[model samples]
Target: MGDRPERIADVEGVDLAGKRALVTGSTSGIGRETALALGRLGADVMIHGRDESAGEAVVDELAAMGREATFQRADYASVDDVRALAAAVREWTDDLDVLCNNAGGLFREGKLTDLGVEYTFHVNHLSPYLLTAELLPTLADDARIVTTSSGAHRGVDIEFESIRSVDSYSGFRAYQRSKLANVLFSNELARRLDRTDRSITSNSFHPGAIPGSGFARFLPGPLPRLFAALGRLPMATTVAEGAATAVYLAASPQVEAVSGQYFTDCEPETPSAAARDTTTQRRLWEESATLLGIDEPLADVEA
Candidate 1:
């Protein structure tokens, strides 16, 4: 936590009073900003991150704003940690109104999780997938699942075999593929929820090119310096701006009936051809469920 107290800014035309939201990776950057924004709009916000002190600081900030808030700590790299997080969330609330999957990063040196999945894929995709499935029973009928995807996913496609194999791993490629998985996961999840008559909406968004938001800090070399310099340039998006679309999807009434869409800058946008493939979306969903050992169809898991 920093010496300065957290700043609370009011967002107009949005009121989340009586609603509950869980925002992952809220220790800093866009995730932190998003959580704070939700709190400003009067949501009961649960801020999550691996750092206990930072998470507690955010909880304190939200509490100061007269919002009900709590902190939960979990490392996304471990499946067991994800399960613990989901269980803790269930204990905290019986019905969740918003689930923001905003925890992710680039692993410069390729590594594998204990489950043998590539580190980037495991954290950025599989962990959120598993967490969302495990918490399905607690979601409200009109709950929003806002996944923080990336524009970097434009050309990448999911490589099921490669996600578990690091023989020729490239960190950038793995991250891109994981972002693609976010979009595909949202797509398939929306379809399944529709079939099951659940009003839950699933959507993913590109947070824009945010340079100071931990996206480049993990780069192996001068790339980090390069990105840092670029972040100071006038064209780069700030953390607050990067969080707008997610906040929009989470609280806006215009999208109340919208689902299975890719969004950028608070507007529905078409994803890459690969991301739009129905068959591929289905395959990715089923494969993700298989990898997570989830036997139930996720759409039917509601309580």
Candidate 2:
């Protein structure tokens, strides 16, 4: 924990006037901070969450900061909800400049959604996948999609057969699997977008651990506090600081031509073997399309 990196001002001086960005799960934690940072950079930001009151509060906070912001609520677990959210958001603006798929949490037990996907897979992976796919038609060329992943991905391999395992499960293991999926999704998606000539880019990151963020609210109280205390001793980055990498990936000129890369802090890094395996990457993309019931395969990346 002592070696955890400090936040750097990576996106300083970048301006995003006229750009409309949406950050999911933004009612609190890194998502909230990311939304604010984008607003501060002059983007018209949309704050998203399941809680309407909390979402409105964030929108109000953004307004007070002189940033144009709005709120949208949806259970990311619900595919219909995400589809409707995409359609509804389109009414406000024609083209989205950035989409941050940041909502997700670790559940202590395995759960399933109406869609029959495992709860962890739904919230942590499928929700973002479905939402981004639904909204693809509305993104501008060079539009950025940032997925907040985690170092926990190191815990698991890409297990197609066991990914949705309900019988054998641990909160931490499920979380790791979903996070690995994020990076895999990003790699495949970057390739897909490259083939389409649309210029949209997708990338994922390891936003350093923020121990007591909303993601842990489901955990028993004393446990989170204990981790928070330990985190302050050098293991954890604050939510505001944790958001720096994402802001850089979305706005910094250094990465303007970079795609299909995983980042930590402000620099590109090699992801795990599973993340770099092109076969696994393509398999995950195809599996995700089937899981989401999307008939058309994503466009192939031009070789």
Candidate 3:
């Protein structure tokens, strides 16, 4: 699923020794690879996931690399849980240098969470939105924010009303909308950060189809088996290949002044017309804050 494997060495001067980073959903797959790559390059990483054991295992692995690591557990379906994660991170460090909003997945059923939002959208889009708001003050000046979007975002456009409840639901469609929201939220965040005169840059990327990332486990019936088989194919995208753009966005000096862009294989590319709509971007940003019941962050950005 990858065109060319992008390596950490591809980006020069990527040493992150004095940086502190947090990667959500770091327990496995692309998230794990992204977190580890950052740690290996010298960023002390905070790992997050629902599984305590798996989360701690990542932390321990990072520790062995001599990078300070901590594990924070939270359920993306719960707003309080997401807030608690950011609060816990605040207690650990005040100068977080890199934030990878890499958590989220496709849910089999489209049901509403307690937050009255569809499960997939809430977990993949809203949770990260809330977490970013909660942790804004904690981010270091010039910190990097990288969100893991997907090429799946290409064809879908989000319906703000439908996020509250889906009547005729298709899992794949829900996933596509959520991914599109990732791009919109990311681009909008970059605009807001810049308008506010903040140096924090926000960007998102498509990590090619990674069949081996254990993501196939969520697929229905025989599809999981099909994906498992595809994972072993010579052309299957490796987890490292899937994680490249994230590492590039997180640590590369090339993008130091770059923001609000969609990327593939470490190079900026134009997203779908729907994804690039600044009108939709602002709409999504406002709707997200309303759903989370929080005052819009960086009020000055919009003022």
The CA lDDT of each predicted structure is: 0.86, 0.82, 0.89
Please provide TM-scores, in order, for all candidate models, with all chains considered together: 0.93, 0.92, 0.96
> In model 3, where do residues sit more than 4 Å from their true spots?
1-9
- Show how many residue pairs clash in every candidate, following the order shown: 0, 0, 0
Misplaced by over 4 Å in model 1 are 1-11, 299-303
Question: Model 1: what TM-score?
Answer: 0.93
RMSD of each: 3.7, 3.1, 2.2
* lDDT comparing candidate 2 with the true structure: 0.82
Highest TM-score among the candidates is held by which one? 3
lDDT of 3 at 181: 97
Candidate number achieving the greatest lDDT relative to the actual structure: 3
* Better model by lDDT: candidate 1 vs candidate 2: 1
